[model samples]
Target chain A: MTESSKRSRQVTFVRFALAVALAGTAGIAWMSFDLGIWDQSGPGPGFLPFVEAIGLGLIVLAGLPAYRASSDLLLMPANVTSILGQAAVVAAFAILMPYFGFVAAAWGIVIATAWLNGERNWLAMLLLGGGCAFGIQYLFAMLGTTL
Target chain B: MSTTEALLHGLMLALQPENLMWGFIGCFLGNFVGVLPGLGSSGAIAILLPVTAILPPTPAIIMLTGIFYGSNYGGTITTVLLNIPGEAATAITALDGNPMAKAGRAGAALGIAAIGSFVGGSIATVLLAFGAPSLAKLGLMMGPAERCALMIFALCLLAMLLGRKAASGMAAALLGLLIASVGIDPVMGMPRFTFGQPELLDGINFVAAVMGLFGMSEVFVALEQRLVGKITENVGPIMPTREDLRVSVKPILRGTVIGSLIGMIPGTNSALASFLAYGVETSVAKDPSRFGKGAIEGVASPETANNAFANANFIPLLALGIPGTASLAILMGGMMMYGLAPGPFLFRDNPDIVWAVIASMFVGNLILLILNLPLASMWIQMLRVRYSLLAPVIVLFTLVGSYSISSSMVSVWTTLTFGIIGFGMKKFDLPIAPMVLTMVLGPLLEANLRRALTISRGDFSVFFNHPISAVILVAAALVLTFLVLRLIFARSRTPSFDSED
Candidate 1:
């Protein structure tokens, strides 16, 4: 286990823990504001949600030891660039989806992804992206959906 | 009515042209997706769920069931031909089937697997037809508290089966429960986790979640590998010799029995059953050393178990309205979409539809056997296609599939987000199955727990009051204790992380 790899693993673990904690906190806060603590019907709908958030927080706190122990053994830096790039593309697709129709948005996303992944063939990319969008549109349309 | 009479009625309903057409379509599409590595019935069914809204209830359920079992049959094709287990359930088949392919006996391996699966599936279907009513009656006796305890037991059992690192599995289950809480609370009609979004008031659609987790994730992985240009091995004719058939009979019988029993338990899917069957067969075999080196029995047992368990998994869902696997969960969703509920009353009220589904399993199994044996050589040729070409198609389908889930752009985003998370998990060597299990089972656990607590007037002792529930809870506790003890002991015996592989 190299020092750099260990550091990378630590970072990943920290990020994961932080994300889980933030999500849990948000869930708890939402429950507190959205639903009362108790009602005549024993417990409100938010009771389980609140408990689940607390459980998640506990798990995040508990993950520290395992994360530290395995940090050196995991983390391959070679794939970091590609993985992060893929994540960026996914985030962009998600952000753009609401603005564009599913077909246009997905087609653009898939083509951009193929280009980023080194598919330089213009005709091939268009065919692949366009064909998929059309086919799915047809299928969904037949099923009475307009995605 | 006797089982035979019911089956006859089922056959009559299944043979109808409308139902038959849907069954065939589902089987065909299911096999197509199953042939792709890493995708399984869950992904295929989730992707197709929204389409069922337009279908009549019978055809919808029939198609969904076909996709579920068809994937079981199709997964073996890649394992035998390319040595790549399409799904975890087919992992054992690759040990021997791939070796047989390498030894110029690909035909024999594929033929035997198909035949074994057919036999196993047939027996399991017969068992389900005869057994479901009785089991359903048993479930009917359970009250709200008992049902909640039962759900807990199922979750605990899932954690146990996941083994060793139980925390990750439980966390994943908790996550699922959280997701399940997003919709209007059934008990109070109050929005719990909806975040004031009307779209979420109805809840995060199961179809979307499943599609994102299984289908989209697979696409991302496929892209990461740049799977194009990879060449597959040459395949031969597809026909099993008499010797192959003779050797497989006993293993098939054993696998069918084991698979059927395991499938009856909620959360223990075909993958676990196949793995367990393989382990049992290997241990009981005369020569255990031959397992990874190409044991025919290894291929036969797991393949048989996979198909058998796929058929029998419906038992709980049909009887108690509790799905045993992710695919079955989607089927339950389909039932709801059709304005029909799946429980004891479903059997009585919709006998034609229920019987048709059961009968179609028999028909589908027969079709799979024939397709696998005669057309396997052709299917094997699929491996020769470059991964690059397939990657684009997968990506395309995934996007479309995710989008179709709710006709909401939000779902597409959700799928993409999960895809990235899935890829990261894969890179970190975390078991993705636990996450899927969590996402699916979490909500059910929460709902049931709350229900039990409410019924008990906030007394936690209610979970242990019922004898069956107490037994299950005790078993869970014992398993957890044993796991902790074993881990502590093993720490001194071994200094390394055990290879889950």
Candidate 2:
């Protein structure tokens, strides 16, 4: 794709992301209002949240003009894959932690991240992963908190 | 206790072998993190905050403070040898430092930075010791209305200074307030945005949020960039020539003055001190053209300014419970997690913690000076390590650290979720510091605002009725108006790039 087209795609993505944020803020504002903003004594619990959410929505709307004028692009597709893949590995670590336990789950995280980082040496990755996993276990054991 | 008496007592406590050892470990770990390209002082501190949970409050804070300043010294090593600054403040150091390295004067450059750092840091510590007590006294006089106004001043200034645009910064700060409201409401006991998770009652763990935002996100960026550095220049003698020192003395003193003044200002970047110092040095030079060509004064000024800025930033944090920078904000979070409230009461209630931390700064700077002078090459060798090898270890550390916060999957999930959010924030050019700072200060702001309102029977003018609060609120308004006008004029001229003026 051409540079201008890439720029347009980036702008569209940012606008969509920002629109979602605005909607979320508006929803929170409504919820906070429903909860009550004031009581007999003074400002209630929802007062701060309601004020902040409303302020945020206004700020986002004000910033839109500057956003339109700016030429910056948010994400380059080439780099996004690497970041997303690594994020996925971390997500999987949280998922697998209960079933596989700390050692196995942590070991998978180390190995997968290292592999994704382009460390092609299998034996090296395995040794590093195993060492880190056991080392963490020993640390927690020393601290009297079993992982 | 008197300031002198308290300081002497604190020095004795800092000299204890256990506290000293923790301080040393903090310096070592901080230097290690600062020597690397991607991981910064904030990330390292966030990831290691949980480990401090196992220790006593004094030693834990001593260690964390050591990390804060030690990283400043370590950043000079990469800037001198690899031209890759290990921290944002060190970016100014690379302008002349890299050129000096290419000219075979890497040792002189590094040596000057070390001496400048030592001198600047020592002077700033002395100033902080004398300054913080008086500042805390002033803080003690503040009522809730005044305190709320001060925080408002800080938040508004931070939103304007930290982000590329005031609106973005204001948006981020508001979002932080919303995040802070996620737990059970302190007043009404109603959940704001908890989604019915029992774990949300205690609120989102600050350490988990920071580790995910700064530490894990950094690793993700590193994996994408794949940064690697090779040492090409030999570090000659680890001492500057007498001539070099003679010329650097003035800059060092000037830089210290510049840094010490800037550091106490809430919401200003420590990096701003370094950049200002460099600019001052260049503008005052006999031959300003020699700056980018490897001027010794160039290396000396920013190095000294940054170290001074690092130490001097403690004044605001220790005295008024306000953090001046992102790393200091994390340090404040760590202090709260340890059940220590930082403010005027801290000096009155916990003089031992306050004074010992101050004394430890002196000791940590001495240790860093010794370490950097003779063992500069050891740090340079660290540059040869690849980012690929470090990324996995960092991820594991962050994950385990998050899990250890509550020993549950909830904190870990928080970490992962914030990590992704942090990445998007970075890409979208939103400032993360304002978000983190507001999140840390949100409860205080809310509580104070409510108390003032209640005291006044819901009269919002109570804030304007108090002299201190009125002055501070007016100042905040002026600052906001100035920033908005400046933004309007600047945006009209050109389309700026991300995170830059």
Candidate 3:
């Protein structure tokens, strides 16, 4: 695809994202109003959030028109596989940390990330990953923080 | 005690072994991260904030502050050697720095940048010393109303100045304020948006959010780009010629003045300071054409300005409890985490921590100069470390850092969630600085607004009634009007979508 066409697609994606955010903020404002914006003493807990959410929703609405006419490229397309792999590894690390222990989970993340970044040497990846996990664990222990 | 006498005492405190050691460690880590591409000082500092919990407030702040300014000096290494700016603050340096490297004058560019940064930093620290106490005194006079107005003014300026578009900036700032209201209300003891999660009662963890937004998200972006550094320039002797020094003197001074002045403003940053310095240098040079073609003045001016700006940014944070940039916002969060309120009362309550931190800046600047000059080649070799190897380790560190905060899975999950959000925001063209800055200041803004209202018996005019608050609100109104007008004019001038098609 041409560069202009690519930018157009990105712009479309951004508009969709903004719409979602607008909806989210509108919902938040409704919920905050339900919680009460004012009380006898003064402004209640929900006051600031309600005000801010309304402001966000309005600003996003006003900004949407400008974005429709904008040709500015928001994001460049790159290696999708690598990006997803990295995110997946981090997510997996978070989940596994509860069951596998910190070191094991950490080591797994390191190895997986390195592999996704195109490290093909298995021995080097394992050694480096293991070393990093133990090293981080040692540093945290020295700080008296239980990982 | 007088300012001079207190400074002397602070210097003595800074020279102590533990303080000096932490300063050195901070500088070392900062330099390491600065040499690496993609990861910035904010991210590095965020990743390390939880670990600093072990130390006393004084040394912990000194270490974090060390990391703060130390990264400025470190960014020049990659810029001069590999033609890649290690951080946004040093991006302008690459214009001439890379050319110098290609011409085998890498040493000269690197040397002048270090020397200039040291000089700029030292001078700015002196100015900060003379200015901060008076500013803090002024801050002490502000009531809750005035303080709230000031925060509103700052947020308005930040939203307008930091965002690509006015509406986007406002939206980002408002999002930040809403997120900040998630926990139990400080005044009413009523939870706002906890969603039945006990962990949400305290609201999102600051360190976790920062680590996710800056550290983990940055790694994800780097992965997508497959960023790698390749150093192709030969670094000659680590010294600038006498003629080089002669040409750079005027630019250095000009850059310092510009940096120090811009640094005091609440919404501006070091990156902007450096950019302005570069623009001034190019405009003033006898042969402006020499810029971007290996002009030594190009490297000297911006590098100096950014370092100067970094040191000067401390004034607002220390004095008025307002962070001037995103990184300093994190530092402010760190200060609050350590049980030290950052505003005027902090001077009376924790004079030792305040003075020691101020004194350490002087020491840290000197340490950076010494380390940068003699150790230039050592830092250059760090460029050879591949990103493939580095990314995983950094991710591990961030995860542990987040987890270390309150020793729970909640913070880790927060980090991961925000990391994705951060990346998505980037792709959507929404700048993250305003979000981060507003997030840090959100609770304070809320508390002050509530206090001001409660004091006035829910009078809506309270914000505009007090003299100080009225003046500040007027200024905010003026800024808001200007931004809206500019946006309208901008839209009128642009070509429509149908025309493009």
Q: What TM-score do all the candidates reach, one by one? A: 0.89, 0.96, 0.95
Measured against the true two-chain complex, the DockQ scores of the candidates, in the order shown, are 0.45, 0.73, 0.73
lDDT per residue for candidate 3 within B431-493, as digits (tens), equals 677778888899989899999999988997988878889999999999888776766677555
* For model 1 chain B, the run of ten residues with the poorest summed lDDT: B492-501
Model 2, runs deviating above 4 Å:
B492-501
lDDT of 1 by residue, B191-211 (tens): 766667888888776666666
Model 2 per-residue lDDT tens digits across residues A1-147: 988898888777777777888898899999899878999889988899999999998887765554667756547534667778898998899888989999999889888998888788888888889999999999899889978
TM-score leaderboard ranking: 2, 3, 1
Quantify how close model 3 is to the true structure by its C-alpha RMSD in Å.
Answer: 3.5
lDDT of 3 by residue, A6-44 (tens): 878878877887799889988998999998889888998
Q: Name the top TM-score candidate.
A: 2
Q: Residue B357 error for model 2, in Å? A: 0.7
Chain A superposition TM-score, candidate 3: 0.86
CAPRI-wise, candidate 2 is: medium
Quote the chain B TM-score of every prediction. 0.91, 0.96, 0.96
Check candidate 3 and list the clashing pairs: none
**Candidate 1, which segments miss by more than 4 Å at Cα?**
A1-34, A37-40, A72-110, A113-121, A138-147, B228-232, B428-444, B465-468, B483-501
Q: Write the per-residue lDDT of candidate 2 for residues B1-501, one digit (tens) a residue.
A: 777888899999999999999999888777776676755677768877787778899999999988877777777887788777655677888999988888889999999999999888988998889999999999999999998999999887775564355667677778888898888887667787777888888788888998988888777767667666667556677799999999999999999999888888876776778888999999999999999989999999989998888888889888998887778888999999888878888988888899999999999999888888888888877677666777788899899989988888888889988887777777676777778888889988888898999899899999999999999999999988877777767755532211211
Alpha carbon deviation, residue B151, candidate 2 (Å): 0.7
